[model samples]
Target: MTALLTLAVLATLLGGTLFAVALDRAYLPLLALFTRQRVETEAPDRLNRDLAPAWYLALAAIGIAVVPFAPDLALIDSPVGIVIWGSCEALIVLTVFLHGWSPNAPFPLIGAYRYAAIGLPVMLPSMFVLIAAALPAESLSLVAIVDSQREVWNVIRQPLGLPLFMVVALAMTLRGPMDYADAADIATGTSAEDSGAGRAVWQIARLAMLVSVSAIAATVFLGGPLGPVLPGPVWLWLKTGALMALTVWIGNRVARTTPSRMLTILWVVLLPLSFLHLLISGLIAL
Candidate 1:
């Protein structure tokens, strides 16, 4: 089990990175459809400022590395597994902010600000979902959360929770319609100044972050490794992949939202809805 868990973590990180790299290349042809003629490929001039791509990568690596182990397969399961996972996921946002700010470029700076502006609002709602998940388990251990769903998955019990969490996950990863951080309107936004291997690392980190978050979501709501007929690890991976695909599809079909509008919706709509979900979940638990 230890070996399997370790392998799952490594595979999620490395595999997600490679998948993201390939996805970027694959999207090139499609991206051209909406791009104006004569899209610029020039690397932005670096500000006379010290930059550390390694720092960005290191932080993201640390943040995502611990998430895959949050389920039953965890090598070091603790009562606070949910808190640990949440902290790590939050670090990904800081990593992005630093990645954008470190370059000291105009577009990237604005993009980083946009990322924070939209990213922060969604976090409370996401936490509400997490709280809802933990309430039934009566413990913060992610494994406990999964075990609580043995009789029935949390998605069915708290139907609003899964979708709400997914929406926040999309925003957290800056994917799909919530991709204003790297939106085309801002010359790829926070990544505009990146080039060569530096850019590659950044892209990989983003993808890995997405994979890690999806894995957590699976564990929290989908009853990780609790499916019938399949091995635990297989079930976990299958669910993670499905969630990742759903997130990607949503991003592809939905129009990109501006940071301000996203903030408005998050505060006025998603926030209240998440609270209502929590209320419903608590009532059901009783």
Candidate 2:
């Protein structure tokens, strides 16, 4: 099980960066992780600046630990894996905000507030979609959730769930249209002051979160580790990798809309729709 977990973690962590590096501009940022000097802002919260990246990465690790490599096999197998993952998602919002707040700069603060505004709204749809996925399994355990999809994956069972959850994916990973925290318009947002290894670690943590979310998405909606012939871990790795690629592709392609418009859409449309998805799922399960 340890070996299985080690493989899964390595595949997830490295794939997050390696797949992204294929993008033309991404390699330099990675190279900078090693070669660049540490950047500090005026009156920065030194503690948070250092700790936020570590915390972000740790949360990503914790999120991955719950993913089952095989039946009843995981690093920290919990019955309420969905909730555990959700908790991590919630904490990330705080972490990103702190990353901005630590810099004590106007642009980063703007970025931080923007993220909070959007990220908080996005969480409702996320949990709703997750709960909708949980309906078929009648259990919150992710392994059970995966087991429930042995015959029919949730993407097919609950068609609305995956697309809605994609918003959550984009938000949690702080990428694509949802990446208000690190948007270029705001001077890379919360990371405007960050440089050197500190910035690199944060970037890597973001990618790791992206991988973590994709893996969870694979587990809930795509019948994780359920492929024929291949070992469970290998199948999981493939599914996770595919989802990672799909996520990055989508992030790169999508453009960010204005924050005010996004907020209206989230509250007026997605939140209610996701709630309906959960309601319908409950009825179907019953």
Candidate 3:
């Protein structure tokens, strides 16, 4: 199990790197047209500046590494697996904040603040969805959650839970419409100062974060590793990929919202809806 988990993590990291590279290459022609050509530039003077993005990348990798494994195969399979998942989600935010603040640039700093403002409100709905998933399982262990859904997947049982969770997952990964953190309007916002290998690492980390959240959402609501005719890991990856693709499609198709409007919708609409979903789940459990 340990070896398999290690292999999975390494594979995900490599895939994430490739995904980032592909995205960059896809946009290279447009980038070359608009991007300013640089001559000679001095290396960063501060050692901390040189190392900070790496630190951010390391945290992102650590957070993502634990996500693909089933609870039985997990390194830490506590009853509070949901809580741990939340902690891992938080690390993605920290990574963005660190990446933005490390360079001490104005736009990046503002972008980091925007990340916090948007990211924090989504947590409420996310926790409610987690609670909805836990209600049927009667255990916080993700393994137990999957087991509880042996008869009926939570998506059918608590339909609202999956959508709410997916929204929060999208927010956590800064994908889709929730991409205020590094939006193009702010000169790539939090990542404005990033270049070369550091930029590559940051991009890889973002993709890995998306993959990680998709895996968790699959586990919680889509019946992770449980499908017809396919192996557990294969089902898991397929679901994760589908969810990731959905997120990307939505991000590309939908217009980005202002921070204030996002907050209003989350608090006024989504928050109450999540609570209602939790209420329904509890009644159904009884």
Candidate 4:
């Protein structure tokens, strides 16, 4: 378990690296589509941008390779299990913050602020859900949670758990309507400065990494790598891909919401939903 978790953490960090690279790549088409429209803002410096592309890609690839070690990592049975779980959430939060701050563009900066602002409320509810889900075992090790879920996914056993985690995961992963960070218009955003291969990396590889990590979260909290016939890795990949597709579809099909309105909706609607799930979980425990 210790080893597996370490691998997952590494994979998660790699996801961040890939996301940064892919973000640069994905912006090209957008730039081309809206050139000279005031939407095609120039990047800070070409040299830095060019240099970063390859470096970030290497980081992402290393991250993916690191994923397989998760199941072998330390279990959440120790006194620090809860602390470890919180750290996972923190690591993700920190990555987004870096993405926002590291860029020399207005949009990335604004996007970073938005990312941090919105993250606060959503993170609280999600943590509560994780605690409730793992409370039964009195440990925060994901391996132990999976072992407990032999008969049922945590989502099934604790109805609220899945929804709460999903809500936060959506925000953390910046999927669907919650993607205010790089919404095409608002700030011109995180992907604003990327071009050429940089844009491609952001669009494809970065999206792939996000999708993969989100899927793993689902597997850990929901029911990892589960299915009949196919092996665990295969099942995990399939489920992750499906969720990624959903996120992309929503990003494409839906109109981007203003950050203020989006945060309001998340806190007002999802917060209650997550807390209610916690209440239900407590009842189940009793």
Candidate 1's residue-wise lDDT over 1-286, tens digit each? 7787667667766776556545545445334433434222345334311243454455445544444343455654678877876676576566667767767678988988898888777788888999999999998877788889889999999999988988887876778888868988999988887665556545555666667777778888888778878777678777877887777778778887678888898899999999999999999988
Off by over 4 Å in 4: 1-85, 200-205, 226-229, 250-255
Q: By descending TM-score, how would the candidates be arranged?
A: 2, 3, 1, 4
Total clashing pairs for each candidate: 1, 0, 1, 25
lDDT of 4 at 68: 29
lDDT of 4 by residue, 1-286 (tens): 5676555555555554344334335445545644433223445544444444344334334324323222333323344444454555565555555555555778787876887777766678777777777766555655565556667777777876655565565665566666766666654466666555455544443454465445545555555555668865555555655555555555455565778887887788877777787788778767
Query: lDDT by residue for model 3 over 1-286, one digit each (tens)?
Result: 7776778767766665455345435446434433544221233324555554565556555644545355355544567778877776676666676667667677878888888888878888988898889998998878788888889999999989988887886777677678878877788888787666556556666666667777788888888878888777777777777777776676667788887899899899999999899999999998
Task: Report the number of the highest-lDDT candidate.
Answer: 2
* TM-score for candidate 1, residues paired by index: 0.85
Clashing pairs in 2: none
Ten contiguous residues with the weakest lDDT in model 1: 44-53
Better by lDDT, candidate 4 or 1: 1
The weakest ten consecutive residues by lDDT in model 4 span: 66-75
Error in Å for residue 113 of model 2? 0.9
Error of 3 at 114 (Å): 0.9
Residue pairs clashing in model 1 are 176-251
Residue by residue across 1-286, what tens digits does model 2's lDDT show?
5786777676666765566556425777687577978977898899998898998988888888888877667777788999999899899999999999998999899999999999898999999998888888888899889889888888888888988988899999988999989888888999898888888888888888877888888888888788889988778778877887888788989999989999999999998899889888888778
